[model samples]
Target: MTNAVFHWPVSSLVQITDCHLLATPDALYQGIKPYHHLRLVLDELRAEAPLLILTGDLTEDHSADSYTLLQQLLADWPAPVFLLPGNHDERGALDQLSQQPPFRPERRLALPGWQLWLLDSKGDTPAGSFPVPRLAELECWLNEAGHQQIFWFCHHHLLPVGSFIDRFDQQDKAGLLAMLKREPRLRGLAHGHCHHAYQYDLPEFVQVGCPASSVQFLQTPDWQTQDQGPRACRWVFTPDGRLQWEFLQF
Candidate 1:
């Protein structure tokens, strides 16, 4: 329910997704030390980007210690950070850190020319879909915006890109897509969870599926591993609502 206002808010933003950090640095997920990978990429992304959007799935174990560790890790980064929740994340765990700076619980975030709708898409199972209440609120927002540009960020993907992640991807993608199709002001949408880096164009907007900052999926069913470089995404927005983006993998 809070609105973030800046005297001269910059339009450029950097998105780091699916960190999946653990309680300990030595702990591993899917044969990869997620903490090690996240740290490596975070060190390199300490550039002049004005905003940082951490899409979701911040912890693999849902440990409070892991969230604390993440907070300490980004304490001094130059840009303001926005944290969105992923399916693996627990809302109570994230809410405990809500009072801290750059650790926000806001569903809607405003930028100079864009309104980032950080939706709550987590369902009862790992595969996420918004609840009826949250869905209603989202629909209202989409209907109310007059001419403001928007960039929707969430934890799951709307389209299945031939990846095995379809099992845990968005369950209500059709409803979500229908909303987007109705809105011409939507500039783009960003997400994590598949651990793959790819972009697709929707007739009037763009969709960016960010790779995990920790690891990636080789293919399907067995959940095999392939060497996926830890990655981050960047978007530079102009006052007039034009956005250009790039993905950085390391």
Candidate 2:
């Protein structure tokens, strides 16, 4: 996210993540079908939106064809949607799919009251990192647009959420925290992949963890069966520049 070409808020934004849709309709992922739940969430998203962001893990099967199905599902949607590739994704396929209409794949958004920097943290494994390039890009954005209140978005958590899955927290979290200390313009952040909802405060901003659109993984990282439920995370920025978030469970 080097620069921001768009200006101001259009409408409320909905973030859908960890959909894990399959290539086949009858496919079972960890015994749960996420595409069905995705449809239900879409039905609930009938309201107007300025933008919609699918924060990755879009397909458990990682089938390039699944994006075609997703395109058809979003064919009638009016608001532009962007994508962020997750660890489970093949970036080549997603990059190609996003170049088409409706999926802009834009990284920087300057809302009426907020500036959004969407980062891709897909590293070598489920755990994520802000690699040299990623960190450099962020520094560039902050240098140019940091005067505006900023909200950072990514596919993985920045810090451990105190559960077993803490193992999957960003490997370079210490670096991230120090960078945040240096950039005072950033106000908050939101992320997906934890499969659980959380709200926590940092020294300067708040961090939110979105619930998954498929099964909810056990908060404790230990080997457990799973928790079943699907939901979408909504970010509401008011006229006063208040960034509020709530999980809409389907």
Candidate 3:
């Protein structure tokens, strides 16, 4: 994992998640061309961002070609890109991206006064899971983080978002939340899986759901599509441990 510390008084990060790109550029998923939509989202981000995080579900078909396509798409991006896996992503296919520059596989990132933990919640099924080993590692990191505020990034939601996707929330959420609660340094959590934007304020931290770059899922109880427009999330972190975020929809 890369452990470089930023010295800037303020740092910004752009999160583009659940791209669901297919193997071919011309392919379509859910009646929308994911590649085209991703292109549109990337174009909208013409401004420079210090860091970019792709939460998960990067490919719809779990093809190496898709990862290669993603690598090519972000080849010229001005900032570093950190990636984690979703239930749909294949580790072997995703690892190919780490071999290249600008595409990082690091799960832990350190900012000036905050630490970002990109946890892997991908499980055997669609629901998320934080295994015992991974949880132990995170606990260790929390202990080592000292007094710095922590922000978690994962692929699945820990809390229900009033949608049908709530059934697929992380199975080990209780354990994870317990660990996080014990650490007063946890400030926020960000995830992308339900394919919509929402926020929930917990006692110790706030959880923000990132919108999908390819499509946005409806908040209805069942799996339904109301909007296919692409979206992204921008996060600003201040040196004093404050986080501000907004959604960019197209």
lDDT of each: 0.77, 0.77, 0.84
lDDT of 1 by residue, 1-250 (tens): 3433232267777788888889998798887888888888877776664567788899989898899788888777666677777988987776666557765656666667777787767777889786667767777886765577877888888877675788888897777777778877877688888788888986777888887888877666657666576888887767788878888888
Off by over 4 Å in 2: 1-4, 223-228
Q: In candidate 3, what are the lDDT values of residues 78-124, reduced to their tens digit? A: 77788888999987766778657787767777777888888888999
Segments in model 1 whose C-alpha atoms lie over 4 Å from true places: 1-8
Q: Residue 241's C-alpha lDDT in candidate 3?
A: 80
Please state every model's RMSD to the true fold in angstroms: 2.2, 2.0, 1.9
Candidate 1 deviation (Cα RMSD): 2.2
Q: List the residue pairs that clash in candidate 1.
A: none
TM-score each candidate.
Answer: 0.90, 0.92, 0.94
**lDDT by residue (tens digit), candidate 2, 63-108:** 8667766776777677777788888887887787677777775788
Q: Give the winner by lDDT.
A: 3
Question: Which 10 successive residues of model 2 have the least lDDT summed?
Answer: 1-10
